[model samples]
Target: MQLTFDADVEEFRRKFVEFLDEHMPAPGDVTERSKSSAHVPDWARRWQRLMFEHGWLLPGNPPEFGGRNATVLQQYVHLEELSKRRIYHSFNPQGLGIIAASILSFGTDEQKQRWAVPILRAEITAALGMSEPGAGSDLAGLRTRAVRAGAEYVVDGQKVWTSGAHDADVLLTFVRTDPTAPKHRGISVLLIPTDTPGVTRRPFPSVCSPDDLDFNEVYFEGARVPVANRIGPENGGWQVANGSLGHERTLLWLSFADRLEDLLGDFRPRTELDRDAYARLVMDSYALRMLGSGALAAAARGEQDTAALSILKVLGSEASQAASERALDAVGIEGLTHPAVTAPPPPLNIEHFSASWFERYLRSFAGTIAGGTSEIQRNIIAQRVLGLPRS
Candidate 1:
């Protein structure tokens, strides 16, 4: 089936393109890159704030939350255009996409005003503190503990792989509030300020690049967070965590699709083997885009097919990894010596796979592991979609 938008949505896209042409930042204005995924530079912050002011930051939310209550189709078009252009709505993606979305989904009116508004407006940033040293894929295995004492909860534990924690203003942290209870039942989430007396963050470099210091290990040594900071009911954090992960996985395929499309557009095969690989990647990218469109259509109809989301996640991420690898392979050893390695980094907002094939290939590994590993996603698809028993 051919995908097309109605007249109003087309008009919306036209207007959005015009807006970008009028206000998009010049390349020189955002030349410096922190090389970290989580840090937002001055120009990015200003760009996000400007979009918020114009109600383009989140077109589905109310004006106070930087939206015009645009239709679902309009929001889809908006995101599509931004991804096609490799523009970042927020430099702190986890803060805007996952944290703010979770707060809006489950937070009280007071909490929404206190936390989500500033996030959408780019006034302050947030990070998710779920993965601990002991807990990576299995969140129920986490060991961090927070005990209640009068009006505060004294927290003590270590969280690893807490991306952007070093630069974030706050962390949506998960802790075990009732260890005696079953593993999943007594979990809870807290909005802990990163600057609390007992909180510490140590950033570590990743394999993607020596300059790309994005991952952090956070320590909480008797950190005292007010009991009022708890999100949702105590011992009900599993539900909140599920909501956050669901939001995180739902639309992430769009970025992978955009990247694959970009790679496919620029590919020029040098040999018979290269042509065969390029053809396979093209078909895979086409299938992924079609699946994404179908998922979006279902969402617009208010039908939640979670199994479809799992399939999209698996296909989109793996396809992107394959495409990046192919791009690097096609270049042979010379790919390793691209100028991006020695040159000052390209502006984060405008650069895509074209930035550096080597860097892109290294960074692609995180895509499989980030939201959930490919192994976990396959198990989900097997059990939920294929009617197979859990192994």
Candidate 2:
């Protein structure tokens, strides 16, 4: 893969930067809530639509799906520019980036026409219905049942930690199609609409914010999705899931890099000790940039390696967590208070730092646990990357 951009890419970059500068949300409005992975805010949705109309929403998708069929390097550059600006391409990443990519790769032509185009156009939100009450990182152990009844599958199960399930239009769901088969062998993916009868959702608020309870518990009882909605062959959901996870891990790395950059810009030191801490934080971020570039380079190769993604996941999440922790310590008591609460005044840009990062430490920790936990990443790295034996 080429490390340097050609003249065409350089031109694309120049225009993209200008586009972002003209369209980015005013500084104060830029926050995690606006970029919620599960919930698409009205403003953010509008932004997505604007990009779609201009053929910039899903640049890697085909022109039939409103993308320009951009090259891999162009796609990579797009992600890098968005991260540099801390701008998310779509609020419903579960729908567009991860699940849609899976559908494009594995879905039947009809299924792709039905699902992929709408997803790329940002016309619907979808939640991944992985991570059952008991399955989680050990997804093959999932017990969610989908009994084939004629032309449809009657799904009955519960999905926990289903981010944005309440707001989603559909679920790219996994279920056991042949329970008597080996654990991984029976699994299948079904695209179930959220409004199907017998589907229910309950929100679970986070420590990060009361208004943003992005996680939910979703229940399915005899909810039927058409057999045609299945992405791959029946009892072949694991392959689809692996493809989805690769896309997800790539996004995780990019977002972590973006957040770390933002944290550095927002860091403010009031003491000599704080200066020492900030220095370490900057150095760690610099190292992470190099590590992150390696991951991007891997993606640019046009084929993903799960082992490589596992390595990047471990490094990126830890680097993000470390930065968040340092931000809290840098501000001392001010970090404990809400930015809206009454508090002592900070000097100069310190106020900006305190306000932006007051609750960020908690958010970052929660984010690390999502997608795949740090512990899970370590296991992947040890077993798959290092060829370590399972004791």
Candidate 3:
């Protein structure tokens, strides 16, 4: 299959590049910011809204749902360009790219009207409640309970590694509705407001830095949410969550592929990435882009492409980790401790990059761990793609 962008997509890329060059933040102008949606600044909110108003935020979304109904080729071009420029689309990128899209698949008409449009409009942000304190990779094993009580479902549970919970207005939460059912069954999804009476949250440390509140721990103590807020049928949340995970994996591969390219561009000459190693990494990154493009193509054609998503996640996440290793090798010891420094301007201008290398290297492990672990992805590829038996 053809790999490079077609003429139409190339032209589309040119237009978007010009638009981003006009609006994206400059190195000096960029504020010191945590990577959390919780710490969204006024400028970030405006920037997100600006992109949304221009029909640039959710390019692949349908027009009825506030997207441009963009072709898959266009979607690939859009994400790659954003990554090339190192643009953070919004503080709530996950909400727009993953959560909102999932809602379209599983939400009721009222649910769509209430949440999806506002998310696309950037009027509010959301967080995912997937990983619990005890159940990280084994999501089906979560113990959080939500029992239906007439008009409301009273929820009581704790979620950890919940990114941006502090700033999120709503949560796409998974809970056990039937304790007697199988591990994967009897679970349900809830669209609960974060400000509910029994809800509480606290920040957690990450390798990005000790003080960085990138992850959060959220607790629900008999949190009452309207029964109407449920996504899909009761005890059928596993299916809805599966849909959300598909969107998330697709977006993650896109983000990581672009980021790998940008990282190379940012530190190629300064870091000690030798010719052979650099070429290898470049090819690996190219392969990732190709896989990502394939996934996008399938999506554009309204296909699931589960195998592609799983393959891309496994390969892309490992490639990023390997790329980070090379970057660290180039930086040696200095990057491990130093947290800020001036970068080469213009052609190689990478703001917040000089002293951020090792820290980024540390955080890169999360890529492999989150969105289903590398081991899990491998099992998926082995079992689903290769049609292997569950040994």
* lDDT per residue as tens, model 1, 1-391: 6479989999999999999889998888987664454677878889889998998988887888888888878988999888766688888888888898888888889999999988887788898999998899999999999999999999999999888889899999999999999999989999999999999999998777666577999999999999888999999999999999887887888888887886777657899999999999999998998898999899888898888888998998898899879878988777776632344433545343334678778878888988888888999899998999985
Q: Rank the candidates by TM-score, best first.
A: 1, 3, 2
What is the per-residue lDDT of model 2 for residues 82-133, given as tens digits with 9 covering 90 to 100?
Answer: 6554456787877887888898889888888788777766677888899988
Off by over 4 Å in 2: 1-4, 18-38, 41-43, 271-273, 301-303, 338-358
Model 1: residue 353 alpha-carbon error in angstroms: 5.7
Candidate 3 lDDT tens digits, 1-391: 7657679889888888887878876555545464576445666667777777777887777666755777877877887776655566766766886778888898888888899878766788888899997899888999999999999999999999998888888989999999999989989999989999999989888767686566889999989999999999999999987888877776578777766776677556453346567788899899987777677777867887777788888888888888878867777787677542354433212224644678778878988987889888889889888999999
> Which one wins by lDDT: 1 or 3?
1
Q: TM-score of every model?
A: 0.94, 0.87, 0.88
| Candidate 1 residue pairs in clash (backbone atoms < 3 Å) | none
**Candidate 3, residue 190: how far the Cα is off, in Å:** 0.8
TM-score of model number 1? 0.94
Which runs of model 3 end up more than 4 angstroms from their true locations? 1-7, 14-35, 266-276, 294-303, 339-341, 344-355
lDDT of 2 at 86: 45
Summing lDDT over every window of 10 consecutive residues in candidate 2, give the lowest-scoring window: 344-353
Q: Which of 1 and 2 is the better model by lDDT?
A: 1
Q: What are the RMSD figures for all models against the true structure? A: 2.2, 4.6, 3.3
Q: Model 3, residue 297: displacement in angstroms? A: 4.3
Tell me the whole-model lDDT of each prediction, alpha carbons only: 0.85, 0.75, 0.79
Candidate 2 local Cα displacement, residue 33, angstroms: 7.5
